[model samples]
Target chain A: MPNYPKGERRRAEILEAAFDAFGTVGYRNASMVQIAADCGVSRAGLLHHFPTKESLLEAVLKQRDRIDNEQFFAGGTSDDGLDYLTRMVRLVEHNAAHPGIVSLFAVLSSEASDPGHPAHVYFQERYARSRSWLRRAFRDLEQRGMLRPHVQPDGLDVEFLSLLDGLQVQWLLQPDAVDMPARVRAFLSRVLTEVA
Target chain B: MPNYPKGERRRAEILEAAFDAFGTVGYRNASMVQIAADCGVSRAGLLHHFPTKESLLEAVLKQRDRIDNEQFFAGGTSDDGLDYLTRMVRLVEHNAAHPGIVSLFAVLSSEASDPGHPAHVYFQERYARSRSWLRRAFRDLEQRGMLRPHVQPDGLDVEFLSLLDGLQVQWLLQPDAVDMPARVRAFLSRVLTEVA
Candidate 1:
């Protein structure tokens, strides 16, 4: 059904190897040689599939995004924002397990905002979309009497999103101490408890 | 009373200029030449006091620690943990005014965890010290009955710290959308009324 079937599989294989390499060793330290060795392929073959380190890094980040969305959102169960908290905890748990991925996101997100950085546009778009979705979810919670009447509708979204972003930084810093999912759960539980 | 009056002044001036430069241009992009120009000094003169860019960056971060301590906990108000929220808001507001400084810290902090990174040890120590201080403060709040009787004693510190760190990431990403101080204030208000 596909032209260049072997090529596609080869590309996917190389990308997987690179992901593992970068996740463990980090973006700066992970090299083409290491990736090729991990894949049991020649260095030239690895480059033939993905020509440059930047290209490989971008591929890994892109793959991560799709995987992350699938893992967290999973496309259903959007009755209230409670799922968001549970999903957030699951995300943190995943990050804790794959500390390398956490490290990659932390190292790159800041530079990604630079406009010229490789992942600049990707990070910006991801952030914008994520923020919009989060705000919409909070608004739904408010409408469904899931939030306090005193919670300013105009400002509620920002509070939720800020707490979410803030906790990620902390979790990345000390995964052993900061259970991101649990903290979100507590805050969300409080939100529900305070609702009108 | 101090020796090298002019030298001290020049060094201070350079650090200030460099701070502004790094904040605006980022650590990687802001060059010593531009920093020298910003301070009305020759590039070599700028280097005479601080030999390397890394050293200058370290000085800037150290300056931030000094300023943060002075403004946030002046007269050692951290004696009670509740007041820390007010200081935290103040810190957030200060950062909003200087987005570059926000970027600087966010950028360095991300790198600060990598053992081989220049600022790694500094950040690691900072996290340890900060966690200890916050844990004691939360414990004090519990002792004063500022928190509910059943509130988990040790975990609140991690939660509070996570909130602080997580909020900053959101603030930087969508500065227009996030009223950091107000968001933090709301979180504190909720925590005080509900848990405290």
Candidate 2:
């Protein structure tokens, strides 16, 4: 078995609690004391793990990305872009099972638009990475003639991401009314149809 | 000559300054004192016009709606759904000129997802109204045989709004990189294509 450091474990515990608090009450309203209480750690103990709220939030967002990457991008090394999109659908399906995390992300991303917001730089980098990845994936699909003839693969990347983000917001607002996974699947299938 | 009450003028000035401050710093980080200073008023003086942060936010949001409605839906009472969409494009084009307001709105709407968030109810009602308006407009287009046969007019409403909002976020993040209005127009054109 791989060695597990006690400090690392404590850090993980703090992050989980932070995510819960931030997701439920929002970043601005969530206090560090509350997060520490949630994690069963003294305020000083939590501070040892993360000295600042911004640092704690950054760690939480990174942890989220690591989990998402592991869960959704594990087999994305395959050359098939369609398969990659299928993985994206799976990720959305997974998101449906975890509404709190989705809400946290949606809320943070929007809040991060303000240049002074703590997550603003983090989100900027995140979007840059995501957009470039999708652009590369779509370009690969185009090379194989999988994308529709009229579709500019790179241009569609922005729209695809937008739909994903937008759908999540709608689903969060009205879970029962918005069947997010179904809508995404249908939309993707239509967009990916091979043109004669 | 039209009469302009001093209180009404001051209220409008406060709102404009508030909108600017909130847009720059985001709702959470923006200070009432700064907004009052921007409007050449004291904190208590500003509070005389709007009592609380939440109340001020609500008023700013309402003012945004009034401006948007006046600008985009001014002449949208006709039977053609395409015309309404054209108006939406115009609104987006207009939004491009005001990145601060767009950023403020995007951030706040996401922040409002938490049930207890002050603007939560406001966003909920705003979304419901927007969706319903689009649904009605799309239904009319379908009745007029304008929508593509494969297009479910009612269903497209959410996706349409999603694209609008999603694109706005992306545009705000990379103002020079994302051509939101053009992308929206292209997407709408594709969706509204008449089936042969």
**Candidate closest to the true structure, highest TM-score:** 2
lDDT of 1 by residue, A1-196 (tens): 3365887877888888877665433455567887888777888888897889999988889888887888887666665665665576677667667666676676666645454556666766776677677677777777777775445555555566555555555666566767766666666655664321
> Which runs in model 1 stand beyond 4 Å of their true positions?
A1-6, A13-58, A73-79, A115-118, A148-156, A194-196, B1-6, B13-47, B52-54, B75-78, B148-153, B194-196
TM-score of chain B of each: 0.81, 0.89
The deviation in Å at residue A194 for candidate 2 is 6.0
Instruction: Return the clash pairs for model 1, or none.
Output: A89-A181, A165-B166, A166-B166, A166-B167, A167-B166
State the iRMSD of every prediction, in order shown.
3.8, 2.1
DockQ of 2: 0.51
**The best candidate in terms of lDDT:** 2
lDDT of 2 by residue, A23-119 (tens): 7666776899989988889999999989999999989898888879888877646756777778888888899999877988887787667677788
RMSD per prediction, one decimal? 4.8, 3.2
Q: Please give the CA lDDT of all the candidate structures.
A: 0.68, 0.77
Which residue pairs clash in candidate 2?
none
Error of 1 at B95 (Å): 1.8
Which digits, one per residue and each the tens of the lDDT, describe model 1 over residues B1-196?
A: 2466898988999998887765543565568888998889887888899999999989998998987787777657647676665567778778778776677777667655555567667776787788788777767776777754334555556666656665556666656666767766666655554321
Model 2 alpha-carbon drift over 4 Å, by segment = A1-6, A194-196, B1-4, B149-154, B194-196
Q: Which ten residues in a row have the lowest lDDT in candidate 1 chain B?
A: B187-196
Reference A-B contact fraction recovered by candidate 2: 0.46
